[model samples]
Target: MKKSNQQLTTIKTLFLGLMVLILTSFSEVAAQNDPVRLGFIPLTDCSPIVMAKELGLFKKYGVEVVVTKESSWANIRDKVLTGELDGAHCLYSMPFSVYTGVGGKAGSEMMIAMMLNVNGQAITLSNDFCGKVGFKQMNKVTPVVAAKLKAEKEVTFAMTFPGGTHDLWLRNWMSIAGLNQKAVKIITIPPPQMVANMKVGNMDGYCVGEPWGGVAVKQGIGFTQIASQDIWKDHPEKALVVNKEFSEKRRTDLVKVMKAIMEACIWLDNPANRKKAAAIIGKAPYVNAPADVIENRLMGNYDLGCNQGTEVYSNDYMLFHKGGMVNYPRKSYAIWAMAQYVRFGYLKEAPNYKAIADKLILQDLYEEVAKSMKVKVPNDDMKPFSLTMDKTVFDPNNPAAYLKVVKR
Candidate 1:
């Protein structure tokens, strides 16, 4: 009987060990299978999404992320709103526009977890138009010359989307050139079709993100009239945007997504890894353009193709890894875009722009995500930045004054 009791005890211990192992395995499987879906437009700025997937950053953070390539910004916004996409590599103004019920169907509120990239957008003018305007070089052409030429003809300007960052940049560029946007015909052309549209003379100029701009200049169909960086240095371009409902329901998952993106951003910014990044972006599925076209601009070396000159510009065209400050969603950055929206009449009037910016930008969420990853956050992410043309200083603290100054 004592021998029988000993065997039963051993069997009992074995059962407990098996149960513990099963529980641990179940926990691991649960962590591995938690789904996080992210959407992206096939632009160069979508590097964060690609890099995160390639580098396994999502898995490192206990997330199984699926990054979907969206056809258009409209699709991205709509899918995210209707629960088709958990988040997306979105236009900087997308969250704000949706929140304010401006872009798509009304009453859709969106939120951005972080800013993904700055600069790297360009305004491309067709070679035919450049010849007609008698502008051999983009930099040599003055705003006055552009305006004079524009007045002589009904110049059609194209942007990727209405109420997008590209649209705002295009409008702001025209405004600075003293050209009335209403006087010029403006149309929406998808970024992928920008080159084809310009080739067919459908548009005289277009403001779009790379590698379409680079592709246009490379294909000899158009010339880079102005790099958006020239207009606003390190301008906010894209962000990781999601609907408010997603943020509320999956707060932890959303934060994890932000953290993974932040890590990918850091990885992409590393100078040593730029060549790899260029090659990665050049793949058929992502930017799907020539490796050299993506490589040159990714390295800050630009060939405008309109002029016989090439130069190394600033590292203003950013992706991912610009150290600590680049990934943080600054309130001022959001407000700056809103100010441009107001400047160009996209917004009827600035309505508590900062408060609206605060609601969409999600600086508090960015900080939490960065802190969780042990990434250092900048103390003054939101600060004053003056533009070269108007010499207007935008103060995040005093947004009303900033708007008033812009209006004046």
Candidate 2:
């Protein structure tokens, strides 16, 4: 009897051990088809992520996904930091903030596994400043803002978040036009609430991603002073930001996710499909704006309001996959953003810009996934580029020198 009992116990132990090993070996398998909760703000650039889940692309790539809309960018950052979210659609400059411990969050290692889209954001001034200001003419808006500042009026301007792309664009736009960003009161507001806040007379102006920019014009609350592309043609706007743990442990899963989004980007680029794309993304659960509000701008038709009237945009209005020009995560752009952070005092001084870019922007992994799908990538990682609106040159080789010139 004792011998039989001993044999049974050993058999049970072996079986359990084998089970553990199998589970551990296929952990990625479990996670790949498991539900990954992703966070996104209600904005047009979030479409790839939204469409990826909605169109069954996430499942097609083996990642069962959930898209939760967040109230603010800060919430998106915090949730991802806490592991409450698996990944997020994020601001171009946001991962840098997370990696650096800026914006009052403990430094969390982050990575940009993919670029979502580019050139669809804008700087908008309140309708009260409508006739008072002109499209793409910050020269006219500067003095009125300056006067309000001098009088100690609220002179409040809002962006989605500090250390976010919108804030940087607004700051650079004002700085180039000789408006002291220091003097003007800058506050953080969520993207969807922008037009409502303006209607309530809460801010003098704001910079945010579409279709809020477009909605503002539609509602007669504000006008786009400038599209972000006008400032820097084809500049990157949003990206698929993932936490470091997810990038390292679930690398295969990340590849799957990236491939799916890249496919969606390809889908988004085709003009023939944009109307349907716009219709799907415009649903209440996604961007929650009218299809017309989102569709027109998504197709490069711009009102350029404050009565500027509707006109066909000549330049690249927005791009998801412009033959990889706007898709690849450029290390140089990250360096330029870091230089701006230093300039704006977001960082005490620039840390190793290259190190940060290398750590946070996973170009190798992106290339691997992109190449598997036969998607073309930029031949060079570093590119020579300058800001169109400000004429500020961002030489990737010498960001510090570029900063010095921009400072003057």
Candidate 3:
């Protein structure tokens, strides 16, 4: 009886050990197969990510993606920092802003993996300035704004995030108009809420990505004063920003995800594919707006609203790939972004520009993916580029000089 009992105990121990090993192996495989969780704000530029998932490009690249629609840029920033999201369709300057202590902790790292899209954002003003500020009417903006401020009326402007593309656009617009930065109020508002807030009189004007600008015009609450491309043609707007751990530890998966997004970008850039792309992204689960409203801008046909008439953006329309010109995470652009922070008082002085760019931009990974996809990278880093808005030349090599001359 004692010998029998001993044999039964040994059998039980071996079975438990085998079961534990099996469970462990299963867990590992499950984790490896788990979908990458990416977040997106409900804007038109999120197409690359949405289309990637919708088109099964992620699965084709041997990974799964779960794209979550986030409410605010602040929410996206927090979740990306806390690892709640692996990455996101993010503002091009957001990671840099976070690392430099503008809107987030000074040293928190959020990595920009690649450019998502460029030149689709716009500055929308309420009907109060409908005739005073026509499309691309930068010259006329300040006087109207100044008149309101002169009357002691609340002259306010809002952007999606501090130190973000829209904030810089708004500030740069304010700067060019020679508006007193100290006199007026500048606040943060999320992109989707911009139109609603404007309708309820929360702000006089706002800068945000499409199709919110398009939506505002469609709803007759506002008019697009200027598209971002009018400020700087082909300027960087949104990016695929990821957490450091995801970029470093899950490199293979990250590359796959980027490749899939790149493929989607290529598809988005094709004119024939844009209508279908717009319809897909307009569904309730994605952008959650009417397909026609999203399609109008997505196709580069803007109804500029409030008797301003229509304008067609042929060459400078929203670019997703532009045959790789739009996707290469350019360090020069990052330098310019940081320089704007200095110019606009977001930062008192410039951070080490190249170091910050190198640390935050996953250039090597982008190059690897670009090569795999046979995408051409424009060798334009550290070069001087001029904005169409003011013709102020930005030499990436001398950001300080650029800042010295820009209006405060």
The model with the greatest lDDT is 3
Q: Is candidate 1 or candidate 3 better by lDDT?
A: 3
Q: Which stretches of candidate 1 lie over 4 Å from their true place?
A: 1-34, 131-152, 403-408
lDDT of candidate 3 vs native? 0.90
**TM-score, per-candidate, Cα-based:** 0.85, 0.92, 0.92
Q: Which scores better on lDDT, 1 or 2?
A: 2
lDDT of 1 by residue, 219-271 (tens): 99887877888778777788888867778767777877787888888887877
Whole-model lDDT, model 2: 0.84
| Order of the predicted models by TM-score, top scorer first | 3, 2, 1
Clashing pairs in 3: none
Model 2 residue-pair collision total: 0
Q: What is the C-alpha local distance difference test score of each model?
A: 0.77, 0.84, 0.90
Which residues of candidate 2, in runs, are more than 4 Å off? Answer: 1-23, 26-29, 104-106, 150-152
For each of the candidates, give the backbone clash count: 3, 0, 0
For candidate 3, give the lDDT of residue 343.
80
Write model 2 residue lDDT over 138-243, tens digit each, in one string. Answer: 6787777867767778788899877789988988888877887777789899999998999999998899999999998888888888888888888889999887
Q: Clashing pairs in model 1?
A: 265-320, 265-321, 269-321
